[model samples]
Target chain A: MAEAVAGCVRHGLPAIGLWRQNVAEQGLDETVRLVKDAGLRVSSLCRGGFLTAPDFEADNRRAIDEAAALEAACLVMVVGGLPGVVPGEPLGEISRDLPAARERVAEALALLAPYAAERGVRLALEPLHPVYCADRAVLSTLGQALDLAAPYAPETVGVVIDTFHVWWDPQVFEQIGRAGREGRIASYQVCDFLSPLPDVLLGRGMMGDGVIDFGPLTGAVAAAGYAGDVEVEIFNADVWAADPDEVVATMKNRFERLVVTRV
Target chain B: MAEAVAGCVRHGLPAIGLWRQNVAEQGLDETVRLVKDAGLRVSSLCRGGFLTAPDFEADNRRAIDEAAALEAACLVMVVGGLPGVVPGEPLGEISRDLPAARERVAEALALLAPYAAERGVRLALEPLHPVYCADRAVLSTLGQALDLAAPYAPETVGVVIDTFHVWWDPQVFEQIGRAGREGRIASYQVCDFLSPLPDVLLGRGMMGDGVIDFGPLTGAVAAAGYAGDVEVEIFNADVWAADPDEVVATMKNRFERLVVTRV
Candidate 1:
């Protein structure tokens, strides 16, 4: 976490998105102090959802408190896929009731929205791609995410527009417009979807490195009234193995060439 | 193809879906003779569309003729994905315009629907899973396929409801209902979507082995008034490598246990 903060400073990057694990490893207070000392803004806390888990409420409460302490824009929420799917455990008799799983997410939000609002932390719901619907996230489209967030105040609950997750959606552009109209566009994340992927979870590519044409997506976000810092979120194995400095430099260059000009 | 017909007869299965490659290798007329002699029905032809390819028109017209000769229910259409993607070739400079790729499908249907109708064959547009949106088929949702079919007569243009493709869609049930109303449910293909897929193209599971609950989906099909023969379309390497007799027996058992009872 300290190295990430220092890297942001060294690379002249203005902000960073902090994952909860990294935050925990460095200790929340120390991590906050490091980012503050480095004069780097916290873009958003990495996550706070996984509503299907046993200790969801307590864990999410702590996540909200951390986001509040960091003064991040919003806490990214990755609503869990299925019930009783513990990390590192062998997947057992899986529940096939997707609608019921989604209902759990809605119920979780109803309970958490007020608490998050009190803490001034918006829960940013991210709709992962449908490929991840069985194992990673049940929310598979921005439209569905918007529907889930409808009951809460837009200030308390918002939806994320991540290119890698949503580029294949038929209704993505229209959903972005709806998000703008509802004032629920919380964060804009960019990454390309590379095919012949080595690993499904870690197959995201840097901007302009794959098949996504950024001009139209960025244009949609801009037209939808999103005036926020765009974040790069690549999880490719090759990218992670590369030198961090080079990765940072490449992402910035790609973002400028492929995203910024269009936006 | 002859062996498949013999196996279907030996297994007491009444019908079979034939792929073009197998038919080509066996000689189309010989395939027709073989199935006829074996007293088996042809549920549907495996494929017909690749609208973005250079020889699509000629190739698809031939596929329609083959389906007609085999007396198949529909000519399944797997619309081409991005333009200029050739099989077994290194992918290079892919066209990222998905909307445009979809428009090409629409245009191709407009041209072929009349021809197919005249030949007493329905062009069944199979909306492949969105995971294949980049390389296999641009038609990723039944709704999109329905929209493309709206211009033609319902008997002439129809959409396929493949479980592996449309199961994850948020609006799948509603769209299935809509397809029923439109009289566009040409075929019902079943295969489970297994996680940690070995090869995305060939990772389909047998019905009872994966996370899909056959009850609601089969119930939906029955409610939607589809009385077509349900086809098994597993593409798994293990299933392919297993003894054909054992594979057929397992599929029959699973179908009875998981799908037929539900319906």
Candidate 2:
């Protein structure tokens, strides 16, 4: 975590999105101190949703507290896949009730919204690609995320516009517009969608390395007036095998050439 | 093809969906004769869309003629994916224009609808699961398929409601309702969604063998007033490797217990 903070400073990047596990491992206070010492901003905390768990409220409250301490932009919420997906096992339809699972998310949000608002931490609902609808997130489109965020105050709950997830959606641009109008464009993450998905969960490629046309999407975000930090997330195995510095360097280059110019 | 027809007769099944390739290999006339001899109805022809291909028109017309010759209910259209995905090569974003690919489908449908209509054949637009949005069919939802079908006569352009594909959709029941209202439910195909999707293309499991709650969906189709042949399509490797007769028997057993009762 220290190295990661230093690496961002070293690479001349402004912010970083920290995963909860890493923050737990690094100790929250030390992570905050390191970021503060490096004069770096925390773009957002990695995740804190999995609302399906029995202990969701306590863990999520802890995540909110951690995000508050870090002064993170928002808490990225990957609101769980289905009711009972055991890790390291084949995904089963323990319950094939998707609507009920989604309702659970809405109810969780209602409870968490005010708590997050009190901490001044925005809960960013990350709508994963529909491909992950069965195993990662029931929120599969920007439109669905916005609908879930509708009843809550925009400051209390927002949405993450990840290119890899929403690029395939037909209503993406319109939803981005709605997100902006509603003041809920919490974060804009960039990555390319690869094919013959190497790994369903971690098949994202660096921008320009896959099939996404960044110009229209980036321009749309810009048009929607999302003047926020653009985080890059590539979860490919080959990219993971490369040196961290090189990966960061390539991300910056691709963002500049394929992403930034659009805006 | 002969065995499939014979098996259907032996199993006391009334109808079967025919793939164009299998029909050609067995000689189209012979296929028609075999089905006729066995008193088996050709519920629908396998496919004819791939609208992105340069030869889509000629081929689709041929498929239309084939469907007509067999007196099939419809020509199933697995509208092609992105424009330039080579068969054995990695799926590249040779073009990241999904909207454009979809537009191509609309255009192809405009031209072919009249042709299909004259032949007394319905072009059944099958909205493949969104996972195949990039590599199989640009039409990713029943709503989208319905929208595309809206511009034509219901008989000329209808939609296939495949449980394996549309089961994950939040708007599925509503769309099925709309399909009924629009008189566009041309076919109802069934299969189960398994995970760790064995192979993206062939991961479909036998009904009741996976997570699909067939009762609600089958009930919805039945409620939509679709009194058509319920086609069983299990593409799993294990099921495919099993004895064909045994496979048919199991499919019938599962369908009776898990699917038929729902309706």
Candidate 3:
């Protein structure tokens, strides 16, 4: 965690998106202090939405607190997939399918929304790709996530525009426009989509490494009036194996070429 | 092919979905005669898409003729994904991506729709799961397929409702209802969707084994007025390696309890 923060500073990056596990490893208070003292901003906290967990409210409360401590823009939420071992739910013995899981997410969000708002921490619902609907997240599109956040205040409930996941969606650009109009574009994540992937979860390619034509996508988002930190979140094995400095350099280059210049 | 047809006869199964390759290997004439002699019906021919191929028109014409020769119900179409490596076309030199591939599919369908209409072979557009949108079929939803089939007569161009492929779609039930109202349902294929899929293509599970709650999905199709052979197309390695008799038995058993009885 320290290495990452120092590396960001060294690379002249604006902010750091910290995962909860990494934050917990370094102790929340110390991590918060370290990031703040170094003048780094938390773009967005990694996550907090496995609503299938038995103690979802309790867990998410802590996640909100952590995001608050780090002063994150919003706590990104990956709503749990089918009624099963939700990422945050160790005691998750849920029996719901897609529709049921979706209902549960609304219920879970209702329970957390007020709390997040009270803490001045926004809840950013992220829609993973439909491929992960069976196991990773029931939320599979930006429109659906926006619908889920409809009843709440835009500041209290927002939607993430993760290019890796939403790049394939036909409704994405329109939804981004809606999010921007509604003041719900919490975070914009960039990553390319690759296929013939051996393991689906780890298949996210670096920006510009795969088939995604990010220029139009970014242009659409920009047209929607979104001016926010765009985080590069690649999960490929090859990308992770490269030197941190190299990966950072490549990401910035791709971000400029594929997104900044076009948008 | 003969063994499968004979087995279907012994088991009192009315029809067998035939793959074109299998028919070609057994000699089209002999295979057609064998099924006809055994009083077995061809539910639907496995495919005839890859529209990006250079010789797509000629190839599809042959497929249409083959389906007519076998008296198959429809020619199930797996519209080719991104342009390159389409089935024919000399290892395929096409460079079109998703949108281009989709446009090519419509163009190819426009050309073949007349040919198919003249021959009495319905073209069944099977929208593969979105996960396959980049590599297998650009048509990733029943709605998309229906839209593509909009300009044609329902009898000439119809959409397939494959439970395994579309079970996760948020718009699925509504789309199935639409297809039925439009009388555009060409085939009803069933297989369960399993996640953490080792091989994306081979991840389709036998009906009841996966997380998919097939009851509602099948019910919607049935409620939409589809009364056709529900072909079970599983590409799982284990199921493929299992004894044919066992595989058939399991599929029938699951189909009854998880689908027939429920829907």
Candidate 4:
């Protein structure tokens, strides 16, 4: 947690997305203190889902409490997949009832939304890639995310646009525009991939190295009037093993070279 | 070449997509004779284009001749990329002038179309996945393919829908429907992938093993009124290394179980 915060501070990155494990490891209070000291914004708390289980009430409330403790701007929910004792596995394998699972997610979000709003934390619904549809998020498209957020006030519910997950989407620009117009574009992440990829979760490229035309993509988002900080989130093992300072410097350089120049 | 044709015959698959090298190895006359003997339809010949180059007229003409000789229903084109020659490579890198390349493709197709029509072969415009956008087909979507085919008649030009390249698209159904309605849906290929995949070419899955809902997809194509063969074109090394008979049997079973049930 300290390392992440320090990296964000040294890199002059305005904000950072935090994983729940990092917070738990440092103790939420210490993590929050470090973030405050660094004067960095919490773009979002890493995640707060896996809510499809039978005992979602307890898990959802705990996520809310953690987000509150961290004073996060939004509790980014990686909504759980299925309902069962083993909480993290996808819900589809055992249950054929997708509509019911979706309803369960909505209910969990509903329960957490008011608390998050009370605590001044927005609820950001991230539509994961379709690969995770069965076990991670049933909400697999930006259109679907907007549809999910349609019933809620923009301040209460919004969407996270992770480039790695959404770059392949033909409707990305249209959806980003819709989100901006509707005031539901909560956060934007930037990452790249050379597809027909394997182990998709970890094989993301470092910006320009992949085929994604980030220039046009970031431009489209900004054109849609999104003013949020661009979060550089790469899950590649290659990047993770590199010197942290070098990685941060490279990202800063790429951000200016690729994103700022285009937008 | 003989092995591939024999495997197709033994497996009872209605059609087989043949690569150009395999066709060349068997000699065009023998290849045609073998395919005829086996009583299998030649779904689509695996190539015809690298036309982004300055000296592609001869190669393009040869490809057309080869397609005619092989008796392929459709000559599937994987259009070439950038203009410069890469070191240690025979062909040059992709050109940045996408519009010029598109025009080149159009010109080549126009010249070959009449000849192809005479030989009773169709020109199938296969819009490759975006990852190949730099060096492969700039026609990366069905919409793009249709747009390219707009000036040509359906009898002269059509689009090939390879599910592996297109299933990630949210607009696939809409585009497939549009293609069918416009009479541009010429060939349909089925293969699956678990996204965040590696080796974009060889990572393809057998039907029903990956994320694509084959039943729904094929059903949509059929509903759009396409009475074409569902070619199971898998490129997985796992499946490729297995006994050829086993692979065919598996595909046959999957076609009946998943595809037939849906259609």
Candidate 5:
């Protein structure tokens, strides 16, 4: 973890996103001190939105605290799918009440929004691809996330516009425009959507490794007035197998060529 | 093909869906004659909607004619995804012009609709799940199918309401009602949606085996006045490996308990 902070600092990367597990693994305070001392901005905390989980309330409360402690821009929330969810396990619904499940998210948001506001942390609701609708996240589109955010102040509840999740949606550009109009675009996460890929949990490819024309999407994000950190959030097995140094180098290369170069 | 028709007759199953390939295998006229002789009804012909295919025109015309010849109620269509699709192959794109690919479907329907109408066939458009969006059907919602069908007569371009394909949709019930009100529900296909299942070609489960709450969805379709054939279109490997008689028997049991008995 310290090496990651050192690497980011050495490489002149101004920001790095933090996964809570990684933070916990390194001792949250220690990890925070390292990144803070190394002059790195925590773009966002990994996640805090399994609203359907049994321990959702306590878990999310801590997530907010951790994100606030790190002074992260936001805590990305994957408002989880069916209650009884385990990756690779057969999708068994504890309740086939999808609307109620969604209601739980809004309901949870209402409870957590004030708490997040108190802690000076924003809840970044990410709309996962619809393929993950059954098991990962029920929120499946930027527009829907914006709708969920409408009840709260934009700062309290904003949407994360991940390129991989929204690229397939025809309404994406229009929704991004709406997000801009509504002041709801919080984090602009970058990834690629290679096809023939199922909604396997760890199936994301690097920016240029897929068929996504990141040009228009990134353009839309920039046009949306999003001047924030663009996190390279690839989750492929091959990428994971590669040396961390190599992955970092490749990520920087792709971000430059595919995202920043366009900018 | 003959055995399937014979089995349907012996079991007194009212109608059987036919794949175009099976029709071709049996000699189209011979299969048509066999079904006609057995005093059977052809509920629907399997498909005719690879609108992105170069030869989609002549192929769909032949499909329309075959459905007409079989006296089928509708010619089910899986509007082909990404131009030049070959299922199970790496998701290749002839062009990443998804909108243009969809436009092609509208254009092809414009050409095929009149011919289908002339042959007394309804074009049943099936919206496969969004997971199949890249390489299968871009039409991922019943509403979208209906939208496409709107520019043509409802009788000429009708939308299919398949339970498995649409169960995850937040707007499914509303869309089904809309499909019914528009009088565009040409087919009401039923199956299960057990997730953790990737978007593999034959990954579908039987009616009762999945997480799908058939009660509400089936009730919604029934409420929407869908008095059409309820086809069980499972593509699971385990089910396929079972004895043919056992499969049929289990299907009947599930169909009665989960779908038919609901009525």
Candidate 6:
């Protein structure tokens, strides 16, 4: 977490999205102090979900406490998949009961939203791509995410639009407009999609290397009234293995050459 | 080419899609005879584009000939990307001129449609996912494919809706309905997306294993007036490496358990 923050700070990045595991590893208080001392904005915490668990109360409260300690702008929730885990295997498979899981997630969000708002931290529902529908998030589209956030005030709960996940969406522009009208646009993450990928989880392209037309995408978001800083969140192993400074330099260069040119 | 066809035949699979290189390897005359002997249908000839070439005439003409000889029901066009080859590398890179490439593909399709119709072969405009918008089919949506095919008679040119590509599309049902209403639903291929996949190309799942609600999708296509056979096309390396008989058995089981139940 500190390495990622230091890289961003060196690269002159304005904000950083910290993952919960990282915060936990460093101790939340110390992590917050480090970020604060570095004068970096916590764009949002990486996540706080899995509310579909049978034991929701304990998990949800702990998540709230962590988000509060981080002083996160938003807690980006990657609502968990199925109920249980098999021995020796990771718990990343979806249960057959999607509608029920969605309902549980919504109920948990409803419970947490007020608490989050009172603490001055927005709870952002990050709708993952449909590919992640089985194991990560049931909310797969921008419309669905916005719909989930519909009952809550924008300041309480909103949606995050990650271009890697949502760029393939035909209704992206219209949904961005809808999100804007509803004031649900929370954060926008940009990345490209190159084919014949090596790792589904980590092979995301740098900003301008793939096929997403970012200019029109950002334009649509801006037209929808979003004026937030564009976040470059790539999960590429290739990028991660490089010197962190080089990675940030490449990200910054791609941001200017590819993304900025398009915008 | 022979291996694919033999597998299809041995498996009692009704149809198989073949790439041009595969066809070339077996020689067209023997390949046609082999397919006929197996009583298998040629669902689609793998591809017929790369139309962005300065001289589209040669590639286009050869593709038409192959499709005609193979007696393919549809010539699935993976319209090419950029022009020019960087020596020693496959001519597979993002095209600098996307608009021009799109136009070239449209022009080539327009020119080939008549010949395809004359040969009783349908030209299936495959709208690839936007991930391939740089170096593959410029047609990135069913709506866009339909728009491209609008000028031609449905009998001459139609659209191929591959579930692997279009399953995530929010407007899928809308565009599918439109295709059905216009009598342009040419071919429908079924596959599933497995998240955290090992390889994007070969990791497509068997029907029920992934996130796709194929029941609703198949029903929508039937409602759209499509009466064609649902081709169970999986590109999994594990499945391919397994005994072909087992692959067939698994596919058949999935069809009966999932697809048949839905339809």
Which candidate wins on DockQ? 2
- After TM-score superposition, the amount by which residue B240's alpha carbon in candidate 3 deviates from its true location, in angstroms, is 1.2
TM-score of chain B of 1: 0.96
Higher lDDT: candidate 2 or 6?
2
Residue A52, model 3: Cα distance from true site in angstroms:
2.0
Superposed model 3: Cα runs more than 4 Å off = A86-96, B85-97
lDDT, model 6:
0.75
| Candidate 6: segments with Cα more than 4 A from true spot | A1-12, A51-61, A80-114, A194-196, A208-213, A261-263, B1-16, B37-39, B51-57, B80-93, B96-108, B129-135, B138-144, B171-175, B208-213
* DockQ of candidate 6 relative to the true structure: 0.21
> Each prediction's TM-score against the native?
0.97, 0.97, 0.95, 0.83, 0.94, 0.82
**Model 2 per-residue lDDT tens digits across residues B22-83:** 99999999999999999988999999988987788998889999999999999999998788
CAPRI accuracy category, model 1 = medium
- The residue-level lDDT of candidate 6 at B95 comes to 52
lDDT of 2 by residue, A130-204 (tens): 767766788888888999999998888999999988887767788899989999999999998777666677878
Q: Write the per-residue lDDT of candidate 1 for residues B1-263, one digit (tens) a residue.
A: 87889899998989899999999999999999999999998999989998977678988889999999999999999998778654434458678888888888888888888889889999999998877777778888889889889888989998899999988899999999999999999999899977655466786899976667777888888789899989999998899999999988899899988887442
Tens-digit lDDT track for model 4 on B103-210?
777776667667667766677888876545545665667877887788877876889998877765546788899999899888888887543254546757888666
Per-residue lDDT tens digits of candidate 5, residues A142-177?
Answer: 878999999988888899999878776767889999
Ranking by TM-score: 1, 2, 3, 5, 4, 6
lDDT of 3: 0.83
Candidate 2: share of reference interface contacts reproduced? 0.36
| Model 2 TM-score (2 dp) | 0.97
What is candidate 1's local distance difference test score?
Answer: 0.87
lDDT of 3 at B21: 96
Residue B2, candidate 1: Cα error in Å is 1.6
Question: Candidate 5, residues B1-263: lDDT per residue as tens digits?
Answer: 99889888877788889999999999999998999899988989988988888888988999999999999989999988778556666654456667778888889889999999898899999998876776778888887898999987888889888887888777788898998899999888887776777545666788877667787887888898888887778878888788877888888898888777454
* Candidate 3 lDDT over residue span A53-75, tens digit each: 56688889999999998999989
